[model samples]
Target: MKIDEIDIRQGTANTPQRSHGNCLPYVGVPFGMNYFSVQTNGAAGAWFFQPDSPRFEGIRLTHQPSPWIGDYNHLLLTAIQWDDATQKPDLAGNYRPTEATFNAHHLALFDDHFNVQTDLIPTAYGAALNYDFQQLELAHHGVAIQLPDEGRFEFTATGLKLAVSDYHGGEDQNLTMFFELSIPNFDAENSGYYDAQNHWHTATNGTGKPLTLLLATTAATVACQLATSYVSAEQATLNLQRLQTSTSATLKNESADAWNDYLGRISVRDHHPAVVQTFYTCLYRLFLFPQRCYELDANQQPVHYDTMAKTVKTGRLYTNNGFWDTSKTVYSLFSILAPELLPKFLRGFLTSYQETGFLPRWLAPDERGMMPGNLVDSVIAEAAQKGLATELMPALLAAMQDSDSKSAISERYGRQGSADYDKFGYIPADNYSESVNWTQDYSYSDYCIGQVAQTLDQPAVAEKYWQLSKRYLNLLDPATGFLRPKTSDGKFKPNFVPDRWGTDYTEGSAWQNSYSAFHDIDGLIAAMGGKDRFDAQLTALCNAKPTYHVGGYEMVIHEMSELAAVDYGQLAISNQPSFHLPYLFDYSGHPEKTQVTVKQLRKLFNASTTGFPGDEDNGSMAGWFIFACLGFYPVCPADAEYALGIPAFDQVTLHLADHDLTLTTANNHEHNNFVQSLCVDGEPFDAVTISHQQLMTSARLETRLGLVPNH
Candidate 1:
């Protein structure tokens, strides 16, 4: 399947808290610093685009990752019909939803009421926008740009210059991005600024204006090429001059070529077209985050503004990534396809640590630290295990130790209770809010530190963290088989409802979080006494009704409601917490059960506009789908192996770093869904796991499936 044929709207058709993948229709190069989406409705804040909305607000150049984190530097670009104010339509005119195209490389809109054809072609730092008003009867047609709430703009003969107020969680919140927009052949004098009072003033020169786009032009086409820079306004103008020479159509083709080069890395041959489309669509999402934030200077070197130190720094930098979301899947996948990119990202993050004095937990423009866990531990550790970026092992291990040894000045960076956790082995409920989850995640993070240490040949560091990794066992209530919160004196929380969402757990109840001991799955099962009891408990966790109360959260969040809506039992695949739950049965010596559960879970995803069954979380869930479709999953990312699962495709051709690794399934018909047997390189592979070494070598993986369970 072609990259241009993939519609980004399939993943982005959503609103806040609601399922159906709460993603924006992003149009940019993979891992671009900025993403562009056509905003049909502007009322929802960061949830600005909805495919069903009838209104065309503008094209929003957004730096928003999620509605939960909101937006930092954002602005709007819209086309206006310059008729008499009496005869002119509303500022936000009604448009045909059917007449707009939503895809990764192209965003084109046709508004008959305004007689405007607005099309946007995206690059990493800028975009080419074409606004055609050939059919409009008005004497002049113009483009209106609404600045951010605290931004400023100025107009010139060719185009304009503006400053986008930049902030998302850094010490230097007052930083700004300088932009140069090249829109030539338009009426320069009539285009100036709009005040808060809704009055337009013509100006050849101005500063600190809230709006820019009052223009009356005779030209049929208004061509705009916008570029931004953190270096200076002069650099911004130079950047625009370099890339704005092509038409929007030509730029769109160029962006499409870039995407094609990326998406063509892996392809599935001789599969259903819908299935093929879903595979490529997921691959598209896998590259959307950890956006490249630095640009080349006049000397052709990487430079980015250090938001924490309020200084321009020389180094590679990236932002808009949540390690909690990307650690397990995105990091692991990249280790296979692009081995070299991992070191670049890790070095960029190391630079962030040097500037900010801490490794980032979650970064938008800066550290937001929204989710639980210092998951970058897993990210760096996985890289170490895969031998992808061994050169950065020393610094990466140091960053992990730094985050583990000391808490940040604020609770949002590094571990929240690093000192306390090191002392108590578990976060006491009295001392922390989400102590249970904090404890659970810390255990896995400790394992990650050990992995990196072991790779660097630090045996003592490896041994100490390996024991610390099992700290989740301290909080496990053996009586209930759940990792319940324990008080300071080491007693489990008095009241425990397995369905009570978010009291001690992150987004789930006790049942969902109990089995997250990824490093010690065997030890966790042994803690439950054996396989019979463990199997029974894992089964009960799924068979129970998806019930909840306000035991933890004041009101039920959407995950609870989504679970009930899907009737998937307590196995909430709609969220990330439960992503590995279905596969947990494999640990209980029931690979057949894991097979059936994952196959049923596969039914929830399709190639429709609302493609995902739940929030894909920056490709974490899609990464799960990508793995499951290929007949395996890396259940524990800290380890370098993948647990087997039912393959969704008949033949998957993976373009790995070394050689092509093809995974084929015999009798992969819809009815023959269970994996009966597996073979690799014409030999019967009896093991339930495949290592990265086994995958990197040139080989063929073939599995036989049956309608009945393998058991």
Candidate 2:
């Protein structure tokens, strides 16, 4: 599939009540610093761009990875024609939602009331916007620039230089981004600023207000170039200067080519066109996150604003991602297809550790410290195992140790309840909320740390962390075959209900969170009385009702509702905890069940406006789909292996950095969901897991599926 064929709006039909992927129709290059989305309702707050809404407020400059995380340094640009004194300050024009283009690299919308057609083509740091208003009877046309918070703008020789300071919640509360906009044919005498209440100021420059720029132009078509930076206004100008010579056609073509380079890496041959579309759309999503926060200065050196230090620093930095989500799937995909980019991502993360004392958990410009565990450990460990960013492994290992040694003073950094976990071998439920997840995740993170340590030839350090990795064993309730919460006294907490949600677990019950022993599935199976019992428990989990008790959350969060909405029983694939549940069957020597279960889950996804099962966090869900569709999954990132499953398509070709790896399925039909046999490079293969080395080196994987189980 080509980049132009992708709608980029898959999984965008979302709301606060429920999430159908919770994704935005973003227009930008892959991993671009900025993204532009059409804002339909500004008053909707985080839920601003609903697909069905007829109101076209403007094109929004958004850095919003998720609605829950909100946006930072955002601005809106709207085009207007005749002004009404009695109307509100911000005007909403009508547009055909179905007619507007929501392509991956470009956006085009026509405002009916204003008689204006707007086109936006995005670059890495900025975008070119063309406004055509020839149909309007009035000669004077205006462009309104809206800022979410207090901002300043100065009229320049080209157009205007604007700066806005805004953030949702992070270590850097006062994050700001500078903007340089070039409008060659604007009327300086009529152009000015305005407040929210129709209070207009006739001045070339303004400061310390929630200012909105109203630039008037008599020209029928207005061409505007916008560039932004976190460093300074001068840097923003430099960013704009790079693209000044490029036209709309060139910008659009360049953006398309950039997206095609990444999206074209995977080519699928499926009989169903929808399957091909879903594959490419999901693939497109896998590259949108961990946006580049660093920008090049005048000397073409990477520099970024250190939000913590309140100054510009020399190095790469990235933001708008949570390690808790991405570590599960995103980095593993990167290791396979985009290994070249991993080193820079890790280096940027290392810079985060240097600026702050701890490695980042959730970073939106800076650490927001959301979720449990420092799962960047998984990213580092996987990258180390794959030989990515090898030069930085030593420093990355030290950063992991620093974060593990002590509890963070602020809630915005490091692992919560780290001291308690170290003392009790488990996070005590009496003191902490979601203690079960905290303990389990920390244990997995320790295993990851140990993986990195062993790779660096630090045997003693590796041994120490590997032992600590078994802390999940401390919380296992052997009787129920679940990892339950324990008090500081080493006794299981009373009133143990496996169906209960949120008191001890992160976002799930024991059924979903119990099998998180990623690095030690054998140990988990052994603790549950070996493979038979483990298999029985997993079977029961899938067949059981998706019932829940709102224990701590006191309400049915969207996850719970989504779980019940799907018919997968207790396997809540809507959230991250259950992402590897089906693959646990692989550990029990039941790859047939894994194959069937995975194929069943594929029914929940498609290529449409509402495509996903739930909130697709920072490419994590998309990454999961990508791996599963290719007949394997990264069940454990710390270990360098993928659990094999049934393929979703007839053929999938992965164009890796050094080589091409292809997977083709035989007798591929919806009913033939269980793998009958498999071969690697024309040799018979019999394994539940395939190594990273084998996948990267092998030429082809052929899977033969049948209606019945092989056993």
Whose TM-score is greatest here? 2
Backbone clashes (count) for model 2: 0
* Candidate 1 weakest ten by summed lDDT: 82-91
> On residues 228-266, what C-alpha lDDT tens digit does candidate 1 reach at each position?
887778878877877867767777888888888768778
Q: Model 2: what TM-score?
A: 0.98
**How far is 48's C-alpha from truth in model 2 (Å)?**
0.5
What overall lDDT goes with each candidate model? 0.80, 0.89
Cα TM-score per model? 0.97, 0.98
List pairs with backbone clashes in candidate 1.
none
The TM-score that candidate 1 achieves is 0.97
Q: Considering summed lDDT, which 10 consecutive residues are worst modelled in model 2?
A: 82-91
